[model samples]
Target: MLVSRQTTVHPVAAPPLQVELADAPPPGVWMNSPQGSAGTIGGVGLRLLQALSAAASIAVMASTGVFPSFSAFSYLIAAASLQCLWSLAPAFVYIYALLVKRSLLNLRAMFIFSVGDWITGTLTLSAACASAGVTIVIDNDRKICAGNLCARFMTAIGMAFISWFALAPSFLFNFVLVVTTFASLLAP
Candidate 1:
């Protein structure tokens, strides 16, 4: 009688930091990949936000439920939902990105961000729609947009106002500083 033998397996070794660096072309920067771009919202915070937004969207969308007869408003709701989702993605990305890095936050900037969120809430959604599932609101009719209902144009304006007056100055100042610093690095 003969018995079969199994070969042993070994774990692969991590690339040496020096070897990894040597493969770079110019501007020898370590960790240049966007792998670290992930926002560090702890599990609890992430879950809470997801639950809250989900509940709010469902309540609002269903409250304005569309039948074949209520087609206009149905399309409107669909458009608004889409836009809100679009805006939230990048807005949340940058916001949490900064927070995770322990970046300094100004009150004015935060206020602007909130306003921007409101404004974007009106956009990134049903710019216009004829179908029930569509929610982007792009209609110019005053009757439809009464008091920022269903993604008003004023919502976009409010976002701009909040961003410029509230958050722009801080972000601009930081951007300029970074540009100047980088320029100095390349100086001959």
Candidate 2:
């Protein structure tokens, strides 16, 4: 009689859980909805508006050699320049998403957009208000307002305000997206 050896086999366990980093909200969430598409479209449009307004403000402000005389105008030009660049980044991203992804679901990107929008919004608003105040003061002086330069200042301020207005919705949308995405990430 021959002795037989016993054999044992162990089944493989499931792989370790992994987390995926998204640049936007969860796919099944709002980012894929009709409302989400509309929001994305609106955001893209706003970015374009922001860029144009900022560029216009810069051009008008720089057109006058006296722009450097007013600190507020300088700040306005700087802020508008920054806003132009900031808006361009998101604008390109949104355009890419529209063409390829059909939706913007990047949580990280939206968060960034929110922060940038707020920053640019605040800067643009303050710059506009400050420049408007200075322009008003200049207008009151009569002598300072002798030239049409004050008109350019008013135009620049108006454009800055428009840029700020456009930034509002974009910021709001991204803020909601970031909050919801974070909440979703925390869910069990």
Per-model TM values vs. the true structure? 0.27, 0.78
The model with the greatest TM-score is 2
Model 2, 105-154: lDDT tens digits are 55877777788888888998899999999999888764577578889889
**8-59: candidate 1 lDDT, tens digit per residue:** 8888998777544443534432233222122223322332343244334434
For every candidate, C-alpha RMSD to the true structure in Å: 16.1, 7.5
Residue 73 deviation, candidate 1, in Å? Answer: 1.5
Candidate 2 backbone collisions, by pair: 23-106, 23-107, 23-108, 24-105, 24-106, 24-107, 25-105
Kindly report the root-mean-square deviation of model 1 from the true structure over all alpha carbons.
Answer: 16.1
lDDT of each: 0.39, 0.81
lDDT score for candidate 1 against the true structure: 0.39
